[model samples]
Target: MSRVAIIGGGVIGGGWAARFLLNGWDVAVFDPAPDAARKIASVLDNASRSLPGIYDRALPAKGKLTFHDTIAAAVEGADWVQESVSERLDLKHAVYAEIVPALREGGFIASSTSGFKAVDLGAKGASVVVVHPFNPVYLLPLVELSGPADLRLRAEPVVRALGMYPLQMEVEIDAFIANRFQEAVWREALWMVRDGIATTGQIDAAIHMGFGLRWAQMGLFETYRIAGGEAGMASYLEQFGPSLSWPWSRLTDVPDLDDALVATIAAQSDKQAAGRSVPELERLRDDNLVAILRGLRQQGSGAGEVILAHEATLPEGGEIDGLPVTASRCVPVTWTDYNGHMNEAAYLELGSWATDGLMRIVGAGPDYIAAGKSFFTVDSRIRYLDEVQCGERLSVTTQVIAAEGKKMRLFHRIMTGDGLVATIETLLLHTDLTTRRSCPPEPEVAAALTRLARAHDGRIAEGCGGAVGERP
Candidate 1:
């Protein structure tokens, strides 16, 4: 098992530990603070509940977590070392000095420093790269990386394996890319609050209710391109470029962090948040992010596309009784209806996924579809015997009912952690994509299907081969 050493137990450090631990990497954490362990545990609890919710598939079994008294102990035998100590240069350097001797030779080192450039971190002759991540690191997939190309290349696969997108910088600069843009907005917001132009809540509302939505999907340039209408980017620039000279923004001025300004911002923020605690707000943020990401998953755009691509690479489900556990997942909040139970359409969707799982089992997946031979469902019957609520775990088991020539029949049982929830029976016909007509599956697929069919011949579900009807 790979091991990572985390040198800090603050929010960012704890987030890093959670990300690594959840991804099946044994983690060693070293923090001198008194409540470091409890703090890390809190972060882990949030991460455990939120990170896996974003994916339809299960993450790897969690790795072992160990807390150490010193940086040397944490870095010992570790494959990777991540420093998230205080941003003070002396503190960071001191931590590095103690860790370098214990760090495994050839192992990678990363710093979660948002304010410092990679070059600055390496000035002490330590080979640390900036692997700066956003808050709730386990949920947000963007990690800004800056360092020597060799080190960046080594870190790319590791970061990507954690379901994060590593954006390698060509030139090192203070604050990096995302934060530079963020700083500009933050400075302007501070000025607005100082000048009494807008409250914190109103400023936040402006983003959350408007361009934030656009930025999440299309980003700035594409959003502007769309705003260009028929003419495109050049026309957009022609129309809006003059606004650059307008005094609409206060980018150059700095807001004094005085008592009154601080109090106003704090009071406004408190009012905006109402009575919700930090943990409550974190959960709210995570849920909204999950919904947005899932929506983008449908379009296969932006961060949603990243998740989709990552999902494609996840390990396939294991088997039960020789048949694959086709679909195992937590029913997302969006899948439930007003009654608080999973909707009718969701049953069919799960059943469809089970059918797709069967297709994969029989060697008829993406390549088969690309090769113009695929299964098309012609008939389906679903029996919802019990209700499943949001956040409940669900698993689907498939039984091959029959497989002969171009025709295949399958039955799926959808079970919750408590008991069986639903069953679906489907009849599918192999088809030639070009001709749009029934066609015999290739020999490999046919043989695999036949094998499964024979294995499940006498194991049919009770609700299989049933018609939709009311009890008399």
Candidate 2:
């Protein structure tokens, strides 16, 4: 039920809006430009399609979004006010001054300014906090928090709630941490282009095809730590320390971005785009990010850990068509095949989780497994009824079939808004984990499964008992 007021509607502002709105914050946006609404809508469209794919559970229900003509109307009763206007000091100061009088008593202003220090930004004595986020705010989890210690403390929970990392800055400096590194690399890249040493495409490939992958998981210093062999970090410093004195990078030099260089860069960038619109390019980037993030999520590393933590806080399960919902989530890009629809293997994975869900309902969850009693799936059959695309929200409902002494049967329907996409019929046997052999379940779990079986007895399942290629 929390509300956020967004001032500005450029790329960064829209991205902030999308992140907060999708995370279930009521958003009020104030942007003077006439096309701001359309721009924000496009960002939201991309965000809604990709952000939730990073998590196992669904994000919170989307909250209300309202556009206002003035900042006062937007900031009234707001829990957090975000200022993402142009980088001009005068403009930001004006926005902050207007925001303070109307901001709720407990609310604070968050500036998306990348380089401004809090001391300068808070000249008006407003409760301003620097919460600069990266491009595509909904997908990138890093947000630099700098300002009043109390205000920064207040912002951490809110940032975590949106599945973002709040990397606190004990000392505020220009451009913060991540962006400073980015600026250094950018300077080097620019120098390379100016020197005619590399084209935009080649430089991009060098990063994406090489160290970028390393950076995604281990980051810079850790990657070098591995490079140090068995000697570790101190050895790394010894090996690379001398190179710092060498003139290897032009980080300190400025490249003349004259018309010729600008033209060359623009032309190369257009070729790289290959006729894709901005939105199209954005979708491609988001898909790649989702695929990479999900892989890292499996390892629980870096930003993937942020996603796992937030997903744990999310509420799970509900009923659909009077059946207990087992697994519900948006299809991630990783689940799709070359044919561009969900692969057959994903259907099996869904069924497996649904089986886990049913076991949990029958008092045989992770704790039961830890206690040495659990269910092991011996066989399963899936009948895919329709195509499922990436980003589609799927709800799986499980229907208990039979719960005899040592065996349990479940039927799962994987559905989208259009209708059922697949049906899974799986059979499991109760097993003692310690012995790794089949066994009868505890009395309570057995009785619970029996109750579910009796409740679903009257329901017809056409796809059950089917062999390969069998049709109902």
Candidate 3:
């Protein structure tokens, strides 16, 4: 197994640890802070509950996590060393000086520095690449990679394996790409607050309620391209390029970091946040991200597309009792209803996923669908036995009850840790895409289904063929 050494246990460092550890990479963390272990553990708790909620399939089992007192102990035998110490050049340099000697031979080193350029980081006489990751690193897939082309290329697979996107920079620049754009907005916000033009809450609303949604999917240029209407980007530039010379933006000046200004900003931020604690705020943020990403996943656009691609590469579920464990996932916050349990629609969705899994077992998957042949549910009856709340783990065990020429029936038990939560019985018909009508399955699919049906014929569970009120 690959090993990653984390040189700090602050927020970013803890997030890095969680990302690597959750992805089944053994992690060694070295931080001098007395509460470092507790801090990292807290981050792990949030990550464990949040990261896996984004995917339909289960993540790899967590790897071993060890905390060490010294950097040398942490870096020894590590495959990758990530330094996330304080951003101060002196502190980073000191950490690097200690880390270089302990780094395993040929192992790569990365610095989670947001401001410093790669050249500045290399001044300490070590080859450390700038791999700046966003906050809540376990969830956000984008990581800015700035370094030599060779090192960046070599590191691409490792980053991708962690379920992250590596955006390599052609030239090493301070603050990198995303942060440069962010800094401009941040500076402007500060100026607005200082000048009493807008409160923190209002500024936040301006973004979250408007362009933020557009930016989440199409990004700036593409979003504007759409705004161009029929004429395209040239029209957009022609219409709006003159605004660049306007004195509308205050990015040219930096807000004074004085006590009064700081206190004002702090008070405004407190008012904006109301009574929610940091953890509460974090959970809220994560939930919103999850909902947004899932919506994107459905459309297969932007970051959602990234998630879909990564999910496709993940290992399929293991089998259970000669049949596949079709569905296994945690109920995300969005799946809950006003009744405080898994919603009715979600139950049907899970059943559909189980049916899709069975189809895959019979060689009728994406390729089959692409070839204009698939299954369409003709009827379904769901029996909800127990309530499941958000964040609860759930699995579905499927049984093939019948499989004939063009028709098949399936039964699925939705299970929680304690016992069964619900059951779904569904009837499906093999379909022809062009005609939109029932059709016989392809030879290979029919044979596979026949084998499964034959094996499961006598092994039907007690609830098989039962209506809502009728139990055998």
Candidate that scores best on lDDT: 2
Number of the top TM-score candidate:
2
Q: What are the lDDT scores of the predictions, listed in order?
A: 0.86, 0.91, 0.88
Which of 1 and 2 is ahead in lDDT? Answer: 2
Which residue pairs clash in candidate 3? none
List where candidate 1 sits over 4 angstroms from the true fold. Answer: 337-344, 370-373, 378-394, 404-407, 415-422, 429-444, 460-462, 465-472
Query: Model 2, 106: alpha-carbon shift in Å?
Result: 2.9
Clashing pairs in model 1, backbone N/Cα/C closer than 3 A: none
Residue 321 displacement in candidate 2 (angstroms): 3.0
Native-to-model Cα distance after best TM-score fit, residue 68 in candidate 1, in Å: 1.9
What is candidate 1's lDDT per residue for 1-472, written digit by digit as tens?
8999999989999999999998899999999899999999988977876676667776677899999987888999999999998889888887778888887877657999998987777778788889999998878889999988899999889898888889999898898999999999999999999999999999999999999999998878999998998999999999999999999988998888999999999999999999999989987887788788788878888887778777777666787666679987767766778897889998998888888888988899999999898999999998888888665667888989899899999889888767888888899999999999998899999999999999898874787765586321
| Better-scoring candidate (TM-score), 1 or 3 | 3
Residue 19's lDDT within candidate 2 is 97
Q: Cα deviation in Å at residue 433, candidate 2? A: 3.1
What value does the lDDT take at residue 190 in candidate 1?
A: 97
Clashing pairs in 2: none
